[model samples]
Target: MEVKHERVKQCLEAMMDSGQLSVGERLPSEILMAKEFGVSRETFRAAVKMLEQEGRLLVKHGVGTFVIQPLPMIPSSLERLSSIGAMIRTAQLDQGESRIKFTKEGCSPEAASALGIKLGDPVVNMERVHTANGEPVAFSMNTIPQEIAGDAFDHDEFQGKLLQFFEKRLGRKIVTADSEICVPLHIDRHCQRLLLHPQTTVLMLKQVHYDEANRPVLFSRDYLRNDVFTFNIRRTT
Candidate 1:
């Protein structure tokens, strides 16, 4: 049996699956991996590089390689937005939090425009550091217009699901909304602190939630760890 790219990929996957690679854990060097797997150093290096490109791992020029813990999975995505709380819970993960602040304030221009409201309108401006398996994976900014958001001002409910609050608590089920996904230039400090890694790219999801009445209810911006989660766009003919 020869140790090749496939074998290296398998070994790495197994380590992650078994919790041996735990998020942020530095991987053994290529030389060590080659000797351990009975493969040439070049072969091991190539395998490591592939994983890095796939966003399952990271490599520092002079330092070493490290494993990146994946985000909560969605079932065969086809361009539908899923609730973060629901996604986290569905994975059977016990949700954990270290809250900084959850408050109500005036909306920013971007938020106001996204919701199609005036510049200084009252908005439910909320912030939270979302974690998965106790590792911070996203910084969430959720804003809703006070006129339409209606009683969304309740701070306690923000701890739960904002999407659900819009439907059940506020009285409307979302039909469709605009969602944009892209990688941002700078990762926020909160992300760096919570993720415990330096200068990783951030995946930005900017969404406007609309109701069955074709009215906008919520506007949200999520900065996710790019190395862990990816948004797939499904096109229909």
Candidate 2:
């Protein structure tokens, strides 16, 4: 005989397959499900916790349990340079915003190396929180030449589009960007501030955008919330 927890899991799976439950849909009450499935209430609660830890369900503090929205699949095309704004929309989630910090400053060693500039080069640092459907999804830190970003007309123009901000704020068109990624088990200070305890592990994406002349037009480091921003990638090698 299967374990009690497995039985509950099986029942949930059946509901999901039948579409009675869906991504982001709530499950029945523990009491209701226990009675409905003829299981002890204790067993039922255990099952819900198991699934919740597995990232299949979300439990609210004072509310009920709900199905989790699946992570967005990473695109197979790793060659393309996509904006954080463009990527979330591609996944069909509403994009949200919170620009934490934006200022003009001198380039640090890391920034210089990434942007191909000497140390102390003037750079504009743009920091913001990227959101998905009103949920904080990632933290982005972008740096660009002060001259381009300093121009008022361009900065205002690029306000809505981070990539466009490059072109409009600095008069430089982005040709490509290099993005590196990883998943982490621990939460960052900022992540804790966002109030998200990722059921599954979290991932990191660090990138630097460069223009046609290979000048580091923008230096960026983005920490994506693993659950909400799922990515899909298809490849053959």
Candidate 3:
């Protein structure tokens, strides 16, 4: 049942992507669309409901459904695990030039607690900036135990994708993360990196990523420009 609804939802998204359905245009009747997709009305409706919750469709009680213009920001799903670079690519936005700097340092008290490492343990400190359409949208700092990241890790090959580097290069699978989200009253340090005004709103996500064996492998803090990024989560009772 879930698979059928997801398939229909993907078809609807493809229609919008191909320009067959334009913003402000009403979708076809549920019965008609269900027939076209060879699915039951319940399944089609479920898919439509999913899209509506995702802010893609406007559904009226008695009137027809209308396509909504997607918000002009990168959308990140809290329920899914993804790298910053992956999020930008999934949004179908043209990526601008980005930069990364790597430094070797002893673990901070905070990093040590999060990564379950002793203070003063060797770690790799990575600072990265992510840009979209020529504007900086996010700044991030990640700390990894030197043993996990390996002394011979190649910065040129990393390119700021920690998840990919862990799985592909290091042969370690990152399966989950524990994240805390917050809004800061002041983020002068992050603002300078994102090239935003001092007063601009920002969302910060502090996370500890765990490997398949439930061992913490990465500790990161990501500062996202509120104007350029939207984070969403789906909750069920």
> In TM-score terms, which candidate is top?
3
User: RMSD of each candidate?
Assistant: 15.7, 17.5, 7.1
Encode model 3's per-residue lDDT on 48-72: one tens digit a residue: 9999988899999799999998765
Residue by residue across 141-234, what tens digits does model 2's lDDT show? 7777675566653344446877775676556788888888765436576555444763734566667887888777777777676666666555
Give the CA lDDT, 0 to 100, for residue 78 in model 3. Answer: 89
Clashes of each: 0, 14, 0
lDDT by residue for model 1 over 1-237, one digit each (tens)?
Answer: 754877988898888889988889998877888898888888888888888866788899899888986555445252566776555555566667735455667879998888888888888777777777878777877887777666646656544666676778788788686888765554555445445576556767788889887878888887777655555554436
lDDT of 2 at 227: 66
Which has the better lDDT: candidate 2, or candidate 3? 3
- Cα displacement (Å) at residue 121, model 2: 2.7
| Residue 232, candidate 2: alpha-carbon lDDT | 57
Candidates' C-alpha lDDT: 0.73, 0.74, 0.85
